[model samples]
Target: MSHASPAPAGITRRQALSAGAALCAGAPASAARRKPNLLFIHTDQHFAGAIAAHGCADVHTPNIDRLIARGVTFHESYSANPVCCPARTAWYTGRCTSESGVVQNDRFPIEPAMPDLGQWFGARGYDALYAGKWHVTGRDFTPSFRVLSHGHGLGEHGDATVARAAREYLRSRRRTDKPFFLSLGFLQPHDICYWVFAHTEPLAALPYPDLARELPPLWPNHGFDAREPETFRKNWRMGRIRQNMERWEEWQWRYYRWSYYRHVEMVDAHIGTVLDALAESGHDRDTAIIFTADHGDGMGAHQLWQKMYFYEEAARVPFVVSWPGELEAGKQDRAHLVSGLDVAPTLCDLAGIEAPPDCRGRSLAPLLRRKPVEWRDYLVSEAATTGRMVRTAGHKFIKYQGDGTEQLFDMRADRGEMHNLAAEGSSAGVAADHRKLLKEWEAHLSPSPAGRLTGTWDG
Candidate 1:
């Protein structure tokens, strides 16, 4: 749990002192006793296991590792709705995808009545500022935070530009009069989608050298599962049938994996830049930083290419919360199931502000303080309207709405999710229990519009 890493090389004494003074300046004596500043750093399509500190051996993420070492890491964190807009909406609104009415990507706008994270914090006198990707709705961000960046367009050097904007904000403009809630959203590994699209040509046709030895190995569960739900199978088949990427050999897949990790590393470097700025600004100790992703990418798992699936590689995300002296450090919480839905409520609770009335998530502030607290018995995640998953201590159950195809895995034994226990007669009772849990969860969801439920599966 010790964050004992060496300081990143090349930082100057003057830069550090100036940044620190800026953070501590102009604070009213009363404001000194107020809430800690909140820094929420979000990434797009970053797999939970891709970080070195999180058990992946193939990728290097020194920055992420340092952050993890300084905080409690949530090993079981998941995206409640594993798509871009839906998952992000859950993070901002503290509501499930169905409740937020954004069940898929680029389709549903958050209803005007619901208060987003920025509005909620801004109402409490925090200067809520947002930078980087804001895909929850259309271009107008006036109702949210004080918008710091515009559009989804990548800047020069991509994520580095986003980090530069954030660093500049911290260094030059951050207000010391009140606690600030800054959300930095970086887009990187999501670029792997463009990579896939632009690299449809055969590897032989490209000019790259053989990299078999340096490439990542295929996932143990790389082969297709016969018992995968028909809806998922159809989606996967359509992707392959359209792109013909199924013709890629093992080495090619390995190369793709290698490239994905490089993108992750690229984003990690930008993250380091922002973190360094925070430390230099002197707010490192007084700021609560929550690091997580909107969702995850498949990273060649199950021979899949992108997200929108309930698979672990796509649904689970890296979640870490660090506030130097206030929260426990260097700890990993593997006992409870956590989700993107918990972020807003947890931040509000830590800041002593009230979350919106319709927020569904429970606060993790008690747990972060190492206090005994009651927790939910099961965790639920949605995939558009086609799939709903329920995960408990020992098992994971996935059901598809269209054909009633079910997948049940004994997570304790088959963490790879290779075996299908739902079809087996002996495991029927466990599946039934999970079914009941899913039903109870569904009962709480507000009804989706007829069009939203029947839209094309565009993943």
Candidate 2:
């Protein structure tokens, strides 16, 4: 069988501009300035306390912790969604999952029509570069980057591939005077080390730090909550679901935690490799570096092992922004609620390009200066499945469609999400407020002329 040849390429700047304007009908014009180079470093399945600087002694993440020390780390930053592709799409596009339709893995490619961050930067004469996972789309779709090195397969040395490509780009940047945008996506912890290294070595043989592993406070103690939803059971991939720890061996939990830390350490090493290249190429000060993750791993929090929920363990991500003089060094911003969706406009602001007005996120540039920016007080997040969450300064509310069960917690008092305050009589107003916020948030993500719903998660 013969395949039809693709149409010829004749897309002019005028046509491209028209297409862009159509998508972002009221977006602002590009500002003229010297564009700063961007080095966006991202990882997969990274939890909030994964870094040693964040107080997780179980793993050694010296390089990442170093970045935190030299940059502004948003202590309470989180992903708009806690799944893989959806979260990543949100991060790059500055929009929610519903806007991009990348709510789950393999749902669909990121909307080609959208004005992506890289594409926006590239339009302003910055050389855009992409390396690593590229899980947002298959090879069929092309990114705005001038150079793309997408390593195929679930390669053993995926991080190495990313490091090598980033190093090369830095070396090339040394020779060129053109400003550039580099997106380095690393796939480490998501590699599933437990299944990869399970049988060959006993879980005990795996190297792990001697520090005690404290469990999250929200989950019911072992041998309780056997009535967890079937969706949670199926997604956890557990051999069996029981109310408590009696059915499962202690080795299971130990293995899970150890592998999670190990993978994080492995990626940290690769990050160091990239940082070394930057210093060697003398772009350390010139390039504004940002480190973040797509989403987080559950790691047995709430007795769940994977993401797709609104629990803190799954939703929150480590967010670090490093700019030597422009951004406050070693400062931690705790009051503001930032989202992965904010990444796009922030990157655009750094590159001196006008961010698409339709982009649902606002720039963090003002916040970086320690100025009071009216940031979103309530950040909304959604799952691949039918779940919606609203996070306020002191509370989080989740409504699971399968059962209409609501999860309410006062995050300020109960960071672990332990006590469900939804049923209590005293917290009725809080619950109602969160519900209204959830509706407003959902309306923004699901904008249409009428009120059509986007596709839902199969779970």
Q: Number of backbone collisions per candidate, in order?
A: 3, 2
lDDT assessment of candidate 2: 0.68
- Candidate 1 off by > 4 Å: 1-32, 173-175, 240-243, 448-459
In model 2, where is the ten-residue run with the lowest total lDDT? 1-10
Per-candidate TM-scores read 0.89, 0.82
Those runs of model 2 whose alpha carbons end farther than 4 Å from true positions after fitting are: 1-33, 138-143, 152-155, 193-246, 447-459
lDDT string for model 2 (1-459, tens) is: 001110001112243234243323322235454556789999888887778999887779999988899898887777877887788777777767676767667756666676666677777788878888766642232556755577544434667888898898788765457787888888877775344334322234335445334422223322223444455455453443323332334555555666678888988988999989988998777778889988888766664556778777778899998977667889888887777877886777666667764666556676776544344667777775747777778898877655555768898887877677877779999998887766555533443211124433222
Give the alpha-carbon lDDT of every model: 0.76, 0.68
RMSD of each: 10.1, 8.5
TM-score, cand. 2 = 0.82
**Top TM-score prediction, candidate number:** 1
